[model samples]
Target: MPSAQSAARPAARSAAGVLGLAALTLLATAPRASAAEGWSLAPAGDGRPSFYAEGAPGTVLQDTVSVTNSGSHPVTVRLTGTGTGTGTGTGVPVTFAEPTVRVPARTRADVPFTMTVPAGAAPGDRSGTLLAKDADGRTATARIRLHVGGPALSALTVEHVAVHGDRITYDLVNRGTTVLVPKLAVRARGLFGRVLLDRAARTLPVRLAPGTRTGLSEPWPGRPALDAVDIRLTATAADGAHDTAGTEARFVPWGAVAGTAGALTAGAAVTVVRLRRRRAGRPAEPPPTDTYTDRDRDTDRDTDVELTGAVR
Candidate 1:
């Protein structure tokens, strides 16, 4: 037998409790509704500002497409490509295996895809798209253009490397390619041991031939004690404005000189010892003694106990 007011109080509290529970449930699910996933695709322009490619019939189709992430959260991207079925192609050989690849906040990455047209591919002109996605399930795409002709007379090579006092020297080969000329640059850095070298802004002005190699010679001053590898040499070549080939050379340890010195000293010592043994037949020196020898007996005792003072 409860009073009316007391009963009312419990009912009110129950209603309030229900309302609170409902509010919490709404708050918990709200994020899913507002959260968004996306990425952006922009045209990848070569430094030269050209966006088209030229390939003739009976040529291999090869080109690169880059996709970047313009998002706040990481996303996954799977790359599938499409183009006019004129050329027999392995469309986009490399890509983000999904709708999105995880791109960290405020960072962009390049996705490279190679399209190889069969020898008989109908290759007057062809195009495709490379897609990039972030984990958020957003998408981005880059356009591709290609031209096929005679063997792309592009080349790449590395040479002229010298190791001087903890430094290395080298050259890059223009191992030929069909369409693009690789702009070349060189760099030197120390191992994980953070030692980055100051490189000059110099570019090779020659169009390296299909069989010719580029020469690289620079005095890269590095840190005092380069622990892991004194200097790391890297050569970058760009074909049609894309970095195509890169090579690295390591410095030789200067300790080799010390090793050479030690060996010479040891050899010289052995030679001297051998010479001394060969001269062993020479007369030997008499052994040293505090006591007089028989020949010097007189010095020890008078030749004859001289009759002192003639029988004084």
Candidate 2:
């Protein structure tokens, strides 16, 4: 029989083992913490994911960004604003009140900023980013969307129309404050007013931003070999944007012209050689002669007889 003291000892050891296993199971089931949960950046107030501003050109807009530090130590960060997208001409002009901020542990720092719409900025939507970086090379960013307000104008122009070897080239210019995906129509006529090329209007594989110019070409693999052509290009876009431009081109078959010129040159040389030969084979001419009639001979004899009688 075991003693009571030894039995109590074994029972206590078993309870201890069970408790240790339960503690390990609880730890394993708990959610793990993220490494980057130390600091964060976001828009100030209202739980908005990004900042938005709408204004006319030359208008100044204001907003705020928050930098929060949840770590035990203080965090020092630098803030910057960077613009993106084709609508933003140069960039989003972001000016921060405090470019550098130091936030104590478990505190948030709110920084104010102003974004100015460029004086001559076109009416469109632009995007940018607000960035916060710490000394450890850790970075956080918040997005910014800006819309420039102005009267929408839809205008475009077709310019510098020309014909290359087997293609027609031209430039499309956007003259309005809106984007354009222009459609092009090509027409070409020959010297005798004969339609050489007639293509219907179709969408082009290009997107033209405001105040931009793009050079493009159309293929003409079956163009005429010899003809004078008048090429016209018309570009049209939505909202009443339209323009047309024309140019003239002449195509000459130099091979055929050279062959004809060579034949003419050979004929001229043959004629020159024949004339020289004829002059060389011809005989020289003699001097001119005179003749008297019988009446003249009788008159001369009578004159001689009269002279002899006078002398006797």
> Which prediction has the highest lDDT against the true structure?
2
Tens digits of lDDT, candidate 1, 1-312: 221111232343355355432110111211111112444554332321212344444333323233433556544456566544223232322233133344555544444333454454332344455555444465544555554455433345455555655445566554454322344344545667564564533555555433445554555465344244434344445543323233345544569768988887787677666656666866875775877577687653562344222222
lDDT of each: 0.43, 0.76
Tens digit of per-residue lDDT, candidate 2, span 1-312:
221111232343355355431110112222221123598887665566677677789877766677778888888888898756655244578888789888888777767677888898998878778888889888888777777878889999999888888888899999998889999999999988999999999999998888899999999998988999998988999999999999999999999999999997787677667766776897864433355667877986997677545433
210: Cα error in model 1, Å: 31
- Supply candidate 1's per-residue lDDT for 15: 53
Q: State candidate 1's TM-score.
A: 0.28
